[model samples]
Target: MASESSPSDPAAWLALLDWRRQISALYARVRELRDSDPPAAHALWQAERNRLFRAHSQSPLLPEARADFVSLPCWPYDPALAFSAPVEFLPLERLDIPSSTGQAMPLVRFGRVELPVGTLDVYWIDVYGGGVFLPFRDAGSGHESYGGGRYLLDTAKSADLGSAPGGALVLDFNFAFHPSCFYDPRWSCPLAPPRNVLDVAVRAGERAS
Candidate 1:
């Protein structure tokens, strides 16, 4: 352990994140203008994309302890997969959640597959009542995939997910990985949407594969 003494104080950690986020926010701005100005936006666009690559890859963002994946029921709910395999994200348009107010993200299938199991990334991101927020299920729910569809990426709070690109970026299942809940059940997780469920087994990414 690096001694809780080093600038590991909560405030320091927050400050570092805040600084990094300012950079991330700048990238979001560039992406918003891609339609109007392709060339100019592309530069800032690439810069921002690189930053995100580093946020999860370069920077020591998640602590080793928190980053460690544990089977559900033993630890607090941590919804992120520590992926050893690498896959590029396939972008898709934002689809709305069937019954609720949420965005649908398309994810392209990876690895060796049998049929055309399309990849569309979608996220139903909200809940009734205060203090309640989560993602939902769809056609691909349960089965070969996670019984509780993969959790969306969160930047706000661990549970609070962020908005998708203007239909620009959506991560694939090879990268879909697992949520913090898979490691520890003490932590709650979002249930996949009924519409999201699918019959064919999605043999890729994180499951028994």
Candidate 2:
């Protein structure tokens, strides 16, 4: 079963709602500017994300860390690392991926996207209100990025970039971000499985701080 915030902490739930709203709004603007002005879009994303992490009530940063938080460390945006790829549908297979908080996430492997870097499995969250969930690990993992992985798209939380004219998903490494668990262990986050590990070092997104 999915977890819910404690009823006693209604303020916490409200903050969470605010955080999701801000994220959705930010991505909507990003999708509008990404095709025409990628650099500007990238700057907007980083600036807004830093703002949230530093002061937003739902920020994943620990209380002590937030006090000293300056900005999230990110690599310079590389236009070449972005692509629009078609999803190759596969026979759905149920899988339970282990999480940082030790909760297993039930997902359905439904498709794959072939990119210049490598192919990555695309999954559906499988539970009610299922959404696209694409997490990946690259050569830079554990060195340049988080050890577990980074998420490219987690539509459940509205982290989607608009699709291309052909309906291909816009996979932009520049917007890739580490999961909340990377900042605080209290968050439960599903990681990339072996099939989603890329051989190339996708040096174009949020980096290890």
Candidate 3:
């Protein structure tokens, strides 16, 4: 079940609504621009993400950290990291995922995709309404990106980047991003499991400076 904000905190409710709208807009723009201009789309997406993290009222950053925020350090767009992979659905199985906050969320393993990096299992979040969830960690995790991992697709919160024709999902590493917990300890985000960890160094996504 989803948590609810206090009825007395109207500001909190408004902030949550604003965040949902912003995320939806970002994903929609990505879907529109990726086909024609992938590089441009990536650049714009990064800029918008920076703006949200730095300027938005409902940013995930801790209150004390926002003042010094400039932009998230990210690697340049690399076309080589983008690929269209065929999804192989696994027999439906639910896995209980432990969170940073000690709560467990159930995610159902629905499919797998083989990419240049490796084969990765795709999970469907087991909530009121289901959504795809893809998180990964690479060799560059501790040094380049967040130590835990980064998110490639978390459609539950509108981070989808769309798919290609012929039933292949567009797995773009250029769009891989850090979870909210990277900035604020209050947020409990799901990390990439052992199966999702790639042996290769994915040096094309968002990194820490």
By lDDT, the better pick of 2 and 3 is 2
Residue 43 error, candidate 2, Å: 0.4
- What's the lDDT for residue 18 in model 3? 91
Query: Candidate 1 — which residues are off by over 4 angstroms?
Result: 1-121, 127-145, 152-167
Error of 3 at 48 (Å): 0.6
The lDDT values for all models are: 0.37, 0.90, 0.85
Please, what are the lDDT tens digits per residue for candidate 1 over residues 70-142? Answer: 3211111122311122223334323333221122323222221121343233332333222312232334445
- Give residue 7's error in model 2 in angstroms: 6.8
- Between candidates 2 and 3, name the one with more favorable TM-score: 2
Error of 3 at 4 (Å): 9.7
Task: At residue 125, give the lDDT of candidate 1.
Answer: 34
Off by over 4 Å in 3: 1-8
Query: Native-vs-model 1 lDDT?
Result: 0.37
Q: lDDT tens string, model 2, 1-209?
A: 12433646768888888999999999999999998999999999999999999999888889899988889998898989989999999999999998877788999999999999999999999888889999999999998999899999999988999899989999999999999988887778888898999999999889996
Native-to-model Cα distance after best TM-score fit, residue 115 in candidate 2, in Å:
0.5
